[model samples]
Target chain A: MNITSYTARAPQLVQALEALAQRADNQDSASTLFHELSGITVLVAKKFTNDRTADGMHDAFHLTVGCISLGISQAGIADSNEAKLSFLLQHGAEYVFQMGFRHIKELSALPYAAYVSDFDNDAFIQQRNLKAIFLEICNADPVSVWTGDAVYQNELLDRKRNRKIIDCAKWLRKNNSNGLVKDSELDANAAISIAVIFAVSGDGCIVARTGQRELENLIARARETRPDVEVNWNDFLKKIPPEFQPILRERMEELRGTIVKKIFSKTKIKTVLTELQDHYAGSEQDIDYS
Target chain B: MSENINLPAIRQQVTELVLAGSPEHAEDAINETAEKFGDLAVVEVLNTLEPHVASLHLSAFDGGKMSLATLLIPPKAWAESLAYFAATWDEDWIEDEPEVLAESLFAHIHGVVFGTDDEERRAELLNEALATDWGTTAFAVLFSTAAEEIIEIANDIHNLGAHRSGRTTSDHDVIPLVLEIARTNEEAWDRVLFEIFPDWKPGENELHTRSEDDGDDHEDEEEREHEYAIGRTTKELLLRLRKQVPSKSSGPAKTGGRPSLGEDIFS
Candidate 1:
């Protein structure tokens, strides 16, 4: 089965990974094993939460098996190879490892690996030195350097808590200010903006406070400001249906009178996101918002 | 009396011609008889031929032969003859194996509705037919037929059905027929949709008239509500269809003659 199918069906695997991550620095007999497993989880999660391209998934899969093997070796497991494989398969590690192995085999134009030993020496290790592994991947495939750069850049930003959503909101606000008048462009950016806001604040309470009228006013202002160019005002206004218009309008009116902080204020953020989703939804744009 | 042609022989010949899959010849024979023996003699011949016409079992080969022959008869006489035929159309027995008879009957009604130049008379006959159970049955059969067959005369069909506006028989019954045409014939489809939803046009007076008529009749409020609901449903269906079936885009027509190869090479 595919890695995605395995991930979905096997909740135990995720729990075990999380448990290992929690005690990642423990000085017990399985300290190295725990760290290795934790390292693999972090790498895979980073690949998942950032760039979810096939290549990224393939890389995640490879690193997963490498660290899993390292963990088993460090723990001094006396089980037979077949038994070990069966245990790994049950735990959801085998799916990713198999896919990764096939991807590598196809790329190198080699026959299928008969056993774990058929894999290169670099495929297993005592511990995952993430930096060294990334550098090695870049050396083997120069195109992967960009992913390495992104990973390092995100590592710096990961230190801050609850900042990504606000940063994304600010970015969207800047984009909106720069005349998102064209229907297609407006819809795409708006969907992304809603998704970011939704991620930060659940239940859409923030948006309910901001209201529809303010967004309507914003669209009117944009159209009025640029009369020379064809800004589809009707197209923009049609984002929210007649049913939701009254309630949204009232909320926006309430938001306008308050001295609310911009991105941090849940009400203001929701107000913006709601307008964007409504507009995007009306246009039937299919970009992933969540 | 001796100079008059044999009406019985003419009737036999006309029947033979129609049964022989040659309604064109039957029409000619009837016209020749009228010209030679006068309208009275031709009428008597048709009277004598009535029994033969009644007994005709129209097969797929001769589905519309009798109707085509009826086109040769005078409109009033044709109408009277058709009335008798329709009264005797045993739907119970015919329904068992109704295809050929239904085709013939539908063709007869179609001719009456369209073959004559008189619009008022056509409307009267159509209204009469629609009011009767037999007529609605014939219409249902014809509606099913019209959907499968490509009726080139959609405009005439549209006009015939359009005459029933505000009548006891709902014009909404013709929706299936119009939609069927719309599926195959783009121009007719556009014509029908435009007729139904004239409000789509800017400054349309028809929709304004509807608004003005609203609340004028308190008793008809329920009927008006039902009609409004139907109208909404029709509009929604049409809009959905418009989304599904993209209209063919026509580019600007090129009227000029072909260009010569004598241009300044790079200019």
Candidate 2:
């Protein structure tokens, strides 16, 4: 359907939802409202899916609406009572993690490594780092919004914890003789290092210094035992082992690319790219013969 | 002095009456003929002689009720009769009432139309519809019918807005209309089902049952087997798609165009 058709139908569906919210008298009425809203949501989802060019923001907007409706349904069930509202609040938290967060993570198509990747690398990296950035921003308490205040603090701590573990795993893999560490041992080591780092730096520190120090000391200990062994974090970071790097890089790139495609594919990227080309049309750098 | 009007001419007149956008004229013609013949024999003769016209009337009546029981006439009969009508009659003879036609057809079909009654039949019909062009046609018809129901729902929603904030309408004013509409429109009912109980699976038989079992003894085993079978099928499909990916082109030269990235990003 054309945009006009969508615009025309959307109001009708929205109106139905509003009606439902107003007249919600019992569980069934609330349930009916939920069902009607869901149908509209599904229709919107299908349209977005079929559009082939719908961007991440568009998809997110649709998801947000669905999420809000779900919240409203819960509220309706609670009958606007404080006791029920408290129950709903707890339920909403669980729903956010179980359904909302999980779905966003899955739909994000973020590379496993990129989730831990430093945010300053490239434009794509910046975009891919939204979840982490959002967590950090939310934690900063820049806005006094209740949801943000509640979420940011927890997410910020969780992300830091998560990042330390990832870094520790990478460090162990780099220093290990066979480039393989026992999963349990890796987890224990990472946990210890993360705890030490958090204790030393407090919650406000952006970088985890103690974790890096512990990781370096561990590598030094491994190198001392095997004198001929080489352990270099820089080398490990800069170049993956020839045998594994290409495959791992390709996989990581694929995942990262999928996320970027999902997000920007339907946005203003086309027009932006076209404008860039036009601006550089006759420049010496525009045509790279080499 | 009745020189006996030519039978074909009479039939043609009847066809025109049926197609003239006048339900009254068509009803009158049928009633007049029945009166003239005064017997079931005449009725049978009329049906045989003007089968297309008769089917049209039948279709109209079925559409009006949105009743599947009347519409699903046997597949062989449906195909033969519809095909004959299409071949013999002009395109203009078919009415543009998509909502009516779809409701009638869907209601009549044992399985696909009314899924609650004969579930096994409904599944078979769903499978058949998905497997054939008729399925697509049926979907289009259903979608059109759904569109009208959706509008009515929108209206109800608007009325609810007016009722809120100390402007109360008697609850009874809203009950019958919404309930009746929901009852008649399968789409609305399905929406209600999905909303109230999001996790309910409609066609669990295919996903749960096995071909070999006929007894309750193997029921649990059958369910597990089918679950495994579905999981395996899903894995195979994913693996097959992965395997089909070709080696990536090295650069723009291989692509024979600038690496646009726009088209590559989405699909």
Q: Which candidate is the best by TM-score?
A: 1
- All candidates' lDDT scores? 0.39, 0.35
Candidate 1, superposed: residue stretches over 4 Å from native = A1-290, B1-5, B16-25, B37-44, B51-68, B72-105, B120-136, B144-267
Which lDDT tens digits does candidate 1 get at residues A248-270?
Answer: 34433443333112333344445
Poorest stretch of ten by lDDT in candidate 1 chain B: B258-267
Residue A228, candidate 1: Cα error in Å is 99
Q: Say what the RMSD of model 2 is.
A: 29.9
State model 1's lDDT.
0.39
User: What would the TM-score be for candidate 2 when compared with the true structure?
Assistant: 0.21
Candidate 2 Cα misplacement greater than 4 A, ranges: A1-36, A40-160, A176-180, A188-290, B1-267
How well is each residue in A1-290 modelled by candidate 2, as lDDT tens digits?
Answer: 46343222221113333444555364554543344333433443443333334553355334434333233332334333343334333443223223333333333333333123334446776445544433332221111122432233345455554454455445434444333433322332322222222222122211111222332343334334432211222233243345433433333344334422322234354442343233311121113322
Residue B69 of model 2, lDDT score? 19
lDDT of 1 at A36: 35
Docking verdict class for candidate 1 = incorrect
